[model samples]
Each structure stands twice: as structure tokens, then as C-alpha cells.
Target: MKHLNSQSFLEDSLKRKVIFLTGKGGVGKTAVAWATALTLSRNKRKVRLISWSPFESFSEPTTLKSLGITWHQLEAAACFKEYALKTLKFEKFFDAVFENRVLKAFIEVAPGLSETVIAGKVWDLFDRGEQDTLVVDLPATGHALSFFKSPMGIEKMFATGFVHRQAGNICDMFVDPYTRVDIVTLPEEMPLVESGQFVEHLMGLGKFHLGFLWLNQCTPDLKVPDKIPSTLDKSIRECLEDHRFRLEREAKNLVEAKKMPLVVKKIPKFSSEAVKETIEQIAAHMEEK
Candidate 1:
């Protein structure tokens, strides 16, 4: 892959309000997401890290916890209860209405209603206006797409009332150009293929701004020795040639990404302990001209 600096693509040196990171599972998306959040926080930006993983807990991974950035694990059940209580607090009449077992049961039974509740809570967080940057460790590509589109989809199904208002507000936040969608991927073939398809799907929606295509765990593009050993077996020589060709192909893809409307970020393969350092490297790359 092309081993260029990260800052080359971040055209705007100013602060970013929101950055969403996503990719296929087990591709280092979460690590990159947390690392990026910490790197931005070091610049004195108020950063919040969120994970939508169903199985994950409120406690962030040790790497992220050590950074001291605010990490939120969004659990649907907890979010629903929090939202319901807040709504009830605001409208005593609603509390009285919900007091009726039938009304409460109806809301619980409604299809897609649970998703709407979660969207409303997410909107409330966005609207609170405290943090400058929100780094979301979103679900896999498909689930993330659904999460983002939840507001709009639910709005259409239930067109009138607070739900509609909440969805409208959330949609505005999403469509903002400053909001960036960062797709994390490995240098391997499958992840890149999925990332490409995800990009295509995002484009088809004509919604949301894609910030960058991040190829993580990239094998560094190292310079070869000046002279090859003549004694090397033919098969070994062919393998070396193939490796070089593959690297060249990756470099071409990076160039193509550079030409796109959004920027592209590349991170080389490193051990987990180096995650923070990697993020710093990424931030430094992004800070470049």
C-alpha cells in the first residue's frame, strides 16, 4: 500500500464535530475508533466514544479506559428506560397515560417502536450539545447502515408527533457535511471488498457524508534490497515478485481513494500495545497539508 502521511487528506485543519467509524467485525475498527478519539482529545477536543455492540458492556476496553475519554456503551434496554423516564418526567399526563397497563403494553408491543425509542435517545445525546466530537464505534457495515437510517425509516412509518420531530432533528445532524463516516478495514481482500460495497451503498442512499476510507492493519511498503540472490529458488523469486505486485496494486487503490471526494487514511500493522501510538501517527498524518 502507499505509505503516505495521514494529514494529506484532512483538508480542514479545524475541529470536527462528529466522526463515525465502522467496518466489518474483527478488523480493528474499535481500536482505531478509540485511538482516534484519544488522539483528538489530546488536542483538547471534547471527545466521546460510543460502542453499539450488543454484547459489550458499559466499561470500555482497557486501552480506551486508560485514555480517560468518555465511553458510552449504548444498550437498547437501558436507553429505552432512560428515555421513557425522561419523557414521563416532562409530561405528568403521559405518566398517567402510561400508568394504564393497556397503553404501556401497546407501546411495548408495537413493531419497530423499540428502535424509535433508541433513536430518540441517540438524538437527545446529539442535541445535548456538550461534546465537540463523537466517535462512534458502530456495528458492522449493514447494521450501521440500518442504525443511521433508523430515524428516517421510523419517521416515515409514524409521521406525526414528537417521534417525527426527533427523527427530523437527528436526520439534520447526519446530513451535515461535517459529520464524517470512517470505514475501517484491513489490507486483506475480504474486508476491502466489504468496505467497497459499503461505500457503494452509502452513495446510493444520497445521505450522510463519508469522511474517509481507512485501511488499517496495513503491511508496510518496505523497500527491497538492491540485489537479489541468484542462488534463490525460482519459486521463492516468484513469491517475492508476487508480493511486490500486490503492494503496487494497493498503492493504486490508495491513489484512487485520494481522488475521491472524501479523504483516505492508512494505518500500518502494529501490535495492540501500539494502538495509541498508531492513532497519534494517524492524527499527525491527518494534520499534514
Candidate 2:
């Protein structure tokens, strides 16, 4: 696999069939995913961006529609129903099985059932080879661990059967050359700590390859005067001090992050609040080679 840097990320994204974007909650991972998908779509590659939840304020479906990218929600129950229908190959049998209260209760409490089915859906989607790229905005930190590990759990639980086979396939796909994960994180202590630990666990699994570590909402290094005027007002001074503090934290975290064996890139805090502009900027940044 190519050792991808920020410069190569955008181009390399096209090379992968699936890219998962995940990080701590509220770190703008979704925006990065959308931008990546949008970039591919603009390049005339068929791209689909998958979300697990309903559209939040930032993810405007109309914008995706206008950009020629498909947006989809890959919910667990829905995907499970789809997979069961295909696997069982009989709608009546599916209804009969699901209609039984005991079976339904068993399904509700079954370990890894939801995650495996979701992973199965992902595998099925890729198996079809219908899209040029599938960009999944995966769940935040802890849930993401379960997302990738579900197949392994299922494989261990089922010694032989279609589910066993499917679980093994998902595991293979996890390490496939065409699949990778990119993480977005803030430079703050809590987020960085969580991200570092997450990376450790992820690498320990050895099932997935990390692509990029994106520093989101970053304040770019700027040439500021050595000191604020002595006459500056208290609030202004506070603001300047806050900016300086952020820069210091960013630098410290960046140094620590760079020590990791992965490419780290920063997505700067935007002056403009326009969602379209933010995505476009990130897309442009990712496209840099």
C-alpha cells in the first residue's frame, strides 16, 4: 500500500473501494467524509456516502444531490432485514422467523448481531461492486471498535454456516487493500488522548489499516506580534491569550501525534461559516498532491 500523506490522500481515496471516517463526537469527521466523497464525485467517480443516523444540520442532502453523490443511511435493522431476506431467499420464511416472539427476543439480545449484519451489509455493498467509492461516516470512538470487531465475534460464535462464512469475508475485507479508515480528531487533551488510545487498540487488532489522522478545526500557525499592546482592553487580551493557548496545545499535540507511524494533517478552523465553503475547502486540501 502507498504510504499516504495529506498530499496523496484525495487521490488515494479513489484507489480504495471503501473509506471509513471516524473520530470523537463533534470533531467534524462527517464533514471530512462528505468532502472526500464530494471530491471523488466531482472527479467523475461514482461515490456514495453512508451515514448511520438521520441528516444532521451540516449534512444537507440537497447539496449532495447537486454534487452528483448519493447519500444513504445504513441502519442496523434495515440492513439486517435486507441481509436476512437475501440469505434465507424466502420472504415468507423471513416473516415467519421474525414474527416469532422468542426468535425476535433472541435476536434482540444476541451478541454482535447488529454489528455483524451491518458489516454484512457493507460487505454485500462492496461485493456488488456497484460504486466506485463508498465513504462511510462511521460511529464515534467506542462504537467504531465494535463495528470492526463484530465480524470476529460472529466468526468465533458460528463454527460453520452462512453467517460464519460471511463473518470471515468481512474480516478479510477489513484487511483488504481497498479498505481503510481515516480518523479526525481535535488537538485538545481529551480528544487526543482518546484518539491515541483508539489507535493503539485499532492497530492491536491488526484488522484495519489507518489512512490519515486529520486535525480538525485547527488554528493554523500565524505570525502574530510578540506582545499585545499594554493598553489593550481586558477582553481583547483574554481573546489573544486564548488564541495563544490554543496554538500551544496544538503544537504540543501535533508533536505527540507525529510520533505515531501515520500521516497527520491539519484542517484549519474556517473564518467562514458556510457549510458548502467548509466542505469545499477541506476537499481542496485533501486533493493537494
**Per-candidate RMSD vs. true structure?**
5.1, 3.0
Model 2: per-residue lDDT, tens digit, 153-224?
777788887888888888888888888888899877788888888888887887577888888988977745
> How far off is residue 201 in model 2, in Å?
1.0
TM-score quality measure for candidate 1: 0.77
TM-score of model 2 (CA atoms): 0.87
Candidates' C-alpha lDDT: 0.68, 0.79
- Our tally of clashes for model 1 stands at 4
What's the lDDT for residue 64 in model 2?
72
Q: Top model by TM-score, which number? A: 2
In candidate 1, which residue ranges exceed 4 Å CA deviation? 1-14, 57-61, 90-116, 231-246, 252-261, 271-289
Span of 10 residues, lowest total lDDT, candidate 1: 1-10
Name the candidate that leads on lDDT.
2
